[model samples]
Target: MRITIANHKGGAGKTTATVNLAAALAELDKRVLVVDMDPQANASRRLARPFDRDAPQLTASEVVRSGEEGVAAQAIAPSGWPSPYTELVSVLPARFDLDNRVSEAGTVGAVGRLRRALQGVDDEYDYTLIDAQPSLGHLTQMAFAASQRVLVVVEPEYDSVEGALRVRDFVKGYAQDLGQPDLRVLAYLVNRARRVGEHAFQLEGLADRLEGDVWTPHIPEWTAAKDAASSALPLQICGSARGPEMATLWTELAKQIIVEGAA
Candidate 1:
């Protein structure tokens, strides 16, 4: 499954969710690949910042910039995450140069390039996660166009609620525009949910609005997440106090994605 985790607003926990979820699924013995679509490269950094500075290297910018066949084959690198299982997951690294490439209007098949690039390697993993940028640009539209499932990560705030809705609409509209009306939001993930007044209210409202499409076992406000990020580790392997809790939560998410996306 090609799942895109996206939100048009920053601080929505999109990268965190992508990294952890891919790690969690890999722990479950799934072959996973994480594509860092964000120019900020936070997901790539979380995977220890694999850079080949000595020679010409493959990055997201180069992958999309290249019209050559099988470019994605060169873009992937082992994630070196030191997981329970060796070679658990891999990441397609990104760099800041992606920002300038994304802004340029020179590419002929701009929005479709990503899908074409990944086609040669899409079957290498059981699941591929795209960590998209925090905006609705052609870069994000490329992700949407290429995705089999779309997950909107939102914090518990009114603006986040609106951002989530916008993402859901983007998937729908993008698919319709591409004549792929079957495409739609596979689910919405609520992150950093708290029991405080506004937070709790917004969570409840989002659940009510999205109904069965909202993922369960919502992530709570916890310092372990930040600790894991700072240490360049996945939450599952960071010895987080919430490790077991998050494991169960993400396993549930993985199964739901498989079943729902399969449908």
Candidate 2:
């Protein structure tokens, strides 16, 4: 399955959700490929790889910009974690140069270029997860273009919820244009949820608005989440802020993805 995690606005815990979810899937013995489309390279950095031309050769930019011929296995790298099978988790790293290239193209259709490139190897993994750039630019569009499902990560804030709604509308419209008429939100993951009553109220409001589409289990604001990011480790393996909660959430997430055929 191909799933894109996107938000028009940043600070919604997009990268954090992507990494931890993918890591959770990996823990289930599923082969997962994470494509880091953000020029900021937070996902790549979290995976312990530099996001620069000097870092590695199989980057998303090279794979997409090189056209059809560029779609090869070399673009993905193992996370270097101590998993029994390192091959279970792979990453298609990106660099800051992606921003410059996309800007020079005059339009963002090239953003969906990653989706076009993915056609070359459709059966290599159990799931393909994309950590999209914050803006609804080419990169984010491409992720939507290539995906059969979308996971909108939203923080418990006004702007985050607002941005998620806009992006949800955009994905609906774009999927129609692409002939994916059945596209539906796989899940709306509430990330960094606080224990404050105000935050709970906001979350309840958002949940009511989104209804059955929302994931009931929310991922709380765990310090280990930050610690894992800084230490370049998957939260499941490196830290213990909310270990039991994370374990249950990921298990539910995996079950949802599997049942929905999103993985």
Best prediction by lDDT: 1
Candidate 2: regions farther than 4 A off: 52-55, 69-72, 104-111, 178-180
Could you estimate the TM-score for every candidate? 0.92, 0.90
Candidate 2 C-alpha lDDT tens digits along 147-239: 888889988788888888878888777787654566557888888899998687888768667553777688878777788788887776676
Per-residue CA lDDT of model 1 for 137-161, tens digit only, reads 8778778777877888988898888
Q: Please, what's the RMSD in Å of model 2?
A: 2.4
Segments in model 1 whose C-alpha atoms lie over 4 Å from true places = 50-56, 84-86, 178-180, 210-212
Q: What's the lDDT for candidate 2? A: 0.76
**Candidate number achieving the greatest TM-score relative to the actual structure:** 1
- Residue 216, model 2: lDDT of 61
